[model samples]
Target chain A: MSDHKILQYPKSPYLKTSYYEDTAIQAFDTPFRKKCLVIGLLFWVCFPFVASSYVVHIANLSAIAAIGAMSLNLLIGNTGLLSLGHAGFMGAGAFTTAIMTVQFGLPIWIVIPASGIVGALLGLIAGLPSFQLKGIYLGLSTLAIHHIIKYGCSEYQYYGGFGYGIVLEAPSLGPLLLAGKTVWFFVLWISAFATALLIANLLRSKPGRAWSAIRDRDIAAEVSGIDIGFYKILAFVVSSSLISMQGSLYAYYTAVVSVEEYSFGLTVSYLAMIIVGGLGSVLGSFLGALLITALPYALIILAGLVDLSFAVKEHFSVIQTGVFGMVVILFLLLEPLGLVEIWRRVRCYFELWPFSYKPLTIIKR
Target chain B: MLLASIVVLAGIYALLGSGFVIIYKASRILNFAHAEIVMLAGYLAVSLAVAIPFSAASLLAVLCFCFVLGMSIYAILIRPLAGYSVLSAIILTVAVGVLLNAVGVFVWRGEMEVIPFGWRTYFSLPGNIRLSSIEFATLGIVTLFYACMGLFYRFTKIGQQMRATAENPLLAAQRGISIYRISGIAWGIGFAAAGLAAFLLGINYAISLQIGNIAVAAFVVALIGGLDSLLGTIPAAFIIAATEQLTITYANPRLGDAIPFIIMLMVLMFKPWGLLGTKEELDRV
Candidate 1:
């Protein structure tokens, strides 16, 4: 077992909690969990009502990003495939939605499914390289593929009379035109919530179990009669399709689909979401998406509240990115389990009350 | 003449490509921050040049600084996570790259060309071949530096330890090799090499956020050569550079950036480990 270390997940020093399955050892399956979930849903449901239009816009973005981060988390956190091209998948979905709705005059319902198919097909193309590539090699191959996709889209936009960007004519269902920030907020939140639930259930099911097995040890997973190739492709397919679906919705929400929007920065933000939120947990992805999506606006608001130097204001965007990078690096080095673990420890500490103590088993395990 | 120009670009790539190959060979992590380190080196050298008022000495100072800086990063950030997931290390480097880019933007702003070394643009050689002296100097320096590196890796005691550690760190540790020191050395050499490439590139043209994209090109080179095979990177660098040159010359200049990646995709599909990369070492991940 010691010799087969690659097959085992690296036990973090701080948190030894398993990412997917909740083991009985923790005693976390309780009324408290249900209570928290209920509260969270209520918070999200009431968010648009209490919040300003700008806040609703941010919520809509976060919800869209949550769907993306969840899809990426499935690949990176659950299946252990590292991709630098998450933005590309999202962009593919967005572009597909744009072209379908604008050119073919398709309804939103029809466009979404078509985008999902295109995204899945593109995912298959991306997955093609993964058959041979592993770890860093796979990551780079995906980066190259991302660049190609980016180049293709830009080229298409340039020649196809949509050089600036393809703007979707506001989506509609017969009489009901999907318009306004609040309406889009509800629409995005529903899909994001649905996807989160689906993934939470799926990860505990057969294919998710297969993915976890493959991630832990592909060789062993194969030895154990898991269809490793099938699961890997399935993970990519599921991840890409959902990402595309989010992009399709985003096309309407943002009302703009352009290559510029889906830059490397977009990829990094999605990565930041997954890493910050916690890798494997659906709840983590959702939380991560919200935190990151809201962060820049919060920064801007903070900047306004506290008067900044003229010099600092000149390079504000660069400073923001630098701060963002520092935050991510700090998290990786200090709190690799991310926000979920932080939340868990706080809850556990409160539950333990005045006698907050550590068991020696965690250190020695 | 076009072939000569391709060779010149290849020569520069050989040096740039080494940035990826060196760290990858030892630690098995692709240092994505390398391009920024290259850009950083250029800016550092420029600032030093301004401060010291001596070009040659400042350049050396910048290179040495780059060497120590790389070693420090490995010791502080990378070593702790060595035995853990490769994915974490990879993303860590991405963060490192982003931070470095932010620093670069803050220091130099968006786009600033290198104050080119005198002798300016192109110099016409005999036989109707045009040679840019700065480019030729870069080619000469990079080739010579790599030649020394090749010899050092082949003949030196530390090099032997590096190779042994790369083969299997646990076994190397069992054999009393300081995996930490060897990896630090790998990073030091890697950064120093990248610094040299950056300096040469700055002399030839502009250094900006765009030059960071060259790291992707270098990644393509490293991939083709086999990530771990330093010697393999030599010809692979030239071939990739030449391919890029040919594409730019014959096809669209925009397409030039993508040709190596298209080649990489095809290679990964057929032969994933790369030209001279060790096969069995792959499954360890």
Candidate 2:
């Protein structure tokens, strides 16, 4: 009992207990981290200028994927919902933007928000089943919704005489035409950054805490007076809205809205992105989006480097799918926590210096 | 003609859905890879028929191979994931399906092929309708399989042990029953059923990668019949198969693909445990 006195003493000299310390984003919590962030921002800002148009285009695509990935992570990682209908949300946004732009002649700004509203409505419908179903059952219901939405989209195209799908004019924002790789890159990456900041802050707030609580244990959360159904629906609405907005941007970027693009495969890829990135982490979402979006290009380059035979090249899509499966399996089996865990381990190894031990305390003197 | 088609389609759904139900009953995990198993069996039937001299021998070989493959999938991939969340297990099954699909594409080159077993002759029915010989074989095979399974479950010691394991795994294990072995047998039987169904489907139509979509319809069947009850799949399959046929024949051909999903959503909305599924099963999931 006397020895227990030593355990009661302050374990670390650098202990922080302020509310601000608890809620503030960890990336900017320390001076060194802030400096690293500044450097990263500078790199991000200069990337378009330094790289070619094709590279900028890829970056823009990654940024768009990053937005979708982050929103999906919010639902699956934070809320524990496991939705397989993310691509449907994105498609709804794309088609909404298409109809608003082509038929009603609405501006890009108006169309984007309209798409988000449509997404929110759809999210409500999608999330309603979550009240009664949990885990994989909820996922299946979302999948059913996805197929329904896909059918509706295709039927609209078929009836509207756009058999090939609707193509839109380059979107203009007021005086400036929002075309070309450079301008869209800025628009997209900035939106991605804003989304990241928004989600990071949201995760620190009451709703975010409620979402995590529900995700960890809904019945326990219910016992603690949390409205389980409300939070679950809120998660779907928010996630779908963001993903739909990204879809709007995607439609504008590609200048096309087609049902073929929003297949079940697309939803699987986004799921892969969040899972591969680091489920609940914002930075992990960005990393995962970048990695998965670039996987095909990376595979092509790798195939070129290896000088593979023409037979393998002919079946490249098949090989790509096989590799995708292998990557997901390896990640789930070996590193279930994802690329973010790898980054944390590397940071820990460097931060710990010559001491080859993991610190038991959160803070060190 | 409509009745004959409905009967044949229902038989196919019953075979596949019962496979899904058995697996879920044993381990409480949804086997998303069941579709891939069906696809693989079709391909195997096509290729092995060309390689082997005897058609019946090749059919047996395919079933035997699929049984082993199913057990291997359980032992290698799914067994490790038992400790994780059910979502992870589901995702792993999807991933395995993707891998198997890629392998199938690589081996078969994604080409459509006909199964050589069935004679393509049509028998005239009493009402100016024609049923293919393959359709007759399908109905006969489905009936025989169900009858055998019914007797096996009631009388066989291994089947009784499996039933015990499914009812209460902990108590079964305490009584010196090996839960893993029972689960492996369930997977084995499930895969064998899928293989037999795929053979019938390939002979009736043509074998291709697209045949995997049949599993989605079967998935709806499993849900409608209750995921835990094997007998429930028969009526559930009839309901789904009739809905699918009616929609395709009367409503629109395009809506045929979407009809099953629409019914599933409606069922989930009103009867989440399914038409025959126990209420407690919903809470357990």
Best by lDDT: 2
Regions of model 2 farther than 4 Å from truth:
A1-14, A360-365
Best by TM-score: 2
lDDT of 2 by residue, B194-228 (tens): 99988888877788988988888999899888888
Taken over the whole model, the C-alpha lDDT of each candidate is 0.83, 0.88
**Per-residue C-alpha lDDT of model 1 across residues A281-353, encoded as one tens digit per residue:** 7878988898888877888989999888898899988988887888778888887877987887776777667
lDDT by residue (A196-235, candidate 2, tens digit) is 9999989999999999888888889999999999999999
Instruction: List TM-scores for all candidates, in order.
Output: 0.92, 0.95
- C-alpha positional error of residue B50 in candidate 2 after TM-score superposition, expressed in Å: 2.0
**Model 2 lDDT, residue B33, Cα:** 86
Worst 10 residues of 2 chain A by lDDT: A356-365
DockQ of each: 0.46, 0.51
Interface root mean square deviation for model 2, in Å? 3.8
Superpose all Cα atoms of candidate 2 onto the true structure and report the RMSD in Å to 1 decimal: 3.8
